[model samples]
Target: MRREIPLLITGIVGIVFVLQYFIPHFPFNRMNAWFSDWFSIVAAFAIWLGALNLMKISFQKVFRRKSDWGYAVVIIMSFLLMAVVGFAEGKGFRDQGTAFDWLFQFVYTPLSATMFAILAFFVASASYRAFRARNFEATLLLLAAFLVMLGRVPTGDVLTGFMPEGMRLSAVASWIMNFPQTAGQRAIMIGIALGLVSTSLRIILGIERSHLGGGD
Candidate 1:
C-alpha cells in the first residue's frame, strides 16, 4: 500500500499537470494550483528528510571519530545555527541584520564562494584530463574550449589581436553554447521525462519493486 499509493499519486499528478498545459480550463487549472500547494508541502517534508539524513550521517561519523568528523560537525552546527537565527529574527522569515542573516552573509557566503573557487580548480583539472589530445574529435573540443575561454577573458582580446575585423569568434562561442549544447540538453530532458513516465507507470502498476528493501 505504501509503495502503490505514492506511485499512483505521482502518475496521476504528473499526467494531470501535462494535460493541464494543453487544456487550460476547468478542473485542470484548479488541479494544477492545488498541486502547486501539494508540491510545496512535499518539498518542506523533503527538506526535513534531508536534514534528518544529514544529522544521521554526521552523528555516525562523529561517533566513529572518522577522518572528516570535524567537517561533519561544522555542517551540522551551521545548519542548526542558521535555523535558530532565522527563527529568532522573524516570526516566519529572517529579517535583514538578524543573527541568521549576518552568519549567512559573512560566514556562509564567503565559505560557499571559497568552496566554488576550490571546485573550479578541480573542474579545470578534470577538463584538462578529458580534453587531452588523444584524437581529432578531442583536439577540436580542446580548441573550442580554448576559443570560448579566450573570448570571455580580457587576455583573450589582447592575445587574439591578429584575428581579422570580419572574424566573429564571439558569435562562434555563443552559437556553440546555445545551439549544439542547448539541443543536447533538450534531448537529455526529453529522455529524462520519458524515463520518469515509464518509472511512474511501473510503480503505479506495481511492476517495479526495487524501492522495497527486499530485492525484487
Candidate 2:
C-alpha cells in the first residue's frame, strides 16, 4: 500500500503535467501551477533533509574514527560555522560586509577556484587522450578541434596571413563552429529530449521504481 499510493499519486501528477502542456487551459493549467508550488515547498524541505543527512554521516565517520575522519571534522566545522554566521546575520547575511558574505567571498570563492584550477589539468589530460586520431572519425574530430583551437588564437591569424581572407584557417574554423557544431548540438539536444520523455513515461507508469528506492 505504501508504494502503491505514491505510485498512483506520481502517475496522476505526471498525467496532469502532460495534459497541461497540450491543453494549457483552465483546470489542467491550474493543477500544474498548484503542483509546481507543492514541488517548490517539497524542494525546500528536501534541502534541509540533505543537509541533516550529510551532517549525520560526517558525525558517524568522526565517531567511528574512519579513514579520512579529519575531512569529516572539517566538513562539520565548516557547516556549523556557515550556518551560525548566516542565521545570526538574519536577512542581510549574504550582503556585503557580513561575516557570511566575507567567508563566501574570501574562503569559498578561492577554494572553488582552486578546485577548478586542479581540474583543468585532468581536463587537458582527458582531452589529449580523446583527441588522439585512432580512426577516420577520430582524425576528423582531431582536425576540427585543432582548427577551432588555432582560430581562437592570434597565432592562427599570423600563420594564415599569406592566405586569402575567405580561405584562412579562421574562416574555416568559423564555418565549422557555425554549422557543424550547431547541428551536432541540436541533434544531441533532441536525443536528450527523447530520452527524458521515455524516462518520464516509465516513471509515470510505475515501471521505474528506482526513485522510490526499490527494485522493479
Candidate 3:
C-alpha cells in the first residue's frame, strides 16, 4: 500500500498537470497555481529534511573520528552559524548590513569564485583534447572553434585586414555560428523535447517506477 499510494498520487498529479496545459478553464486553470503552492510547501519541508540528514552524517563522522572528520566539524559549524544569523536577523537577514549578507558576499562569493577558477584549468584541458584534429570531423570542429574564438577578438580583424570584407575570418565565423550552430542547437532542443514527453508519459502511466526507489 505504501508504494501503491505514492504511485497513484504521482499518476494523478502528472495527468492533472498535463491536462492543465491544454484545458486551461474552470478547475484546471486554478489547479496549476494550486499545485504550484503545494509544490513550494513540499520543497520547504524537503530542505529541512536534507539539512537534518547532512547534520546526521556529519555528527556520525565526528563521533567516529573518521578521516577528514575535521571537514565535517567545519560543515556543522558553518551551517549552524548561517542558520543562527538568519534566524536572529529575521526579515532583514538578507539586507545589506546584515551578518548573513556580509558572510555571503565576503566568504561564500570568494569561495565560489575560487572553485570556478580552479575548474577553468580542467575546462581548458578538456577543450584542448576535444579540439584536437585526429579525423575529418574533428578537423572541421577544430577549424570552426578556432575561427569562432579568433573572430571574437580584435586580433582576428587586424590579421585579416588585407582580405576582402566578406571573405574575412570574422565573416566566415559569423556565417558558421548563425547557420550551422543555430541549426544544430534547434535539432538538439527538438530531440530533448521528444525525450521529455516520452519519459513523462512513462512516469504518468506508472511504467517507470524507478522513482519509487526500486525496479519493477
Q: TM-score for candidate 3, please give it.
A: 0.92
Distance from true location, Cα of 54 in model 2, Å: 1.5
Per-model TM-score versus the true fold: 0.70, 0.88, 0.92
Better of 1 and 3 by lDDT: 3
The numbered model that scores best in TM-score is: 3
Q: Note the Cα lDDT for every prediction shown.
A: 0.79, 0.93, 0.93
Candidate 3: clashing pairs of residues: none
Residue 115, candidate 2: alpha-carbon lDDT: 94
Where is the poorest 10-residue window by lDDT in model 2? 24-33
Which lDDT value does model 1 have at 118? 99
After TM-score superposition, the amount by which residue 58's alpha carbon in candidate 3 deviates from its true location, in angstroms, is 0.6
For model 2, the superposed segments whose C-alpha errors exceed 4 Å read: none
Candidate 3 lDDT over 162-203, as tens digits, reads 999887878888999999999999999999999999999999
Candidate 2 Cα deviation (angstroms), residue 21: 1.3
Candidate RMSDs in Å, in order, are 3.9, 2.1, 1.7
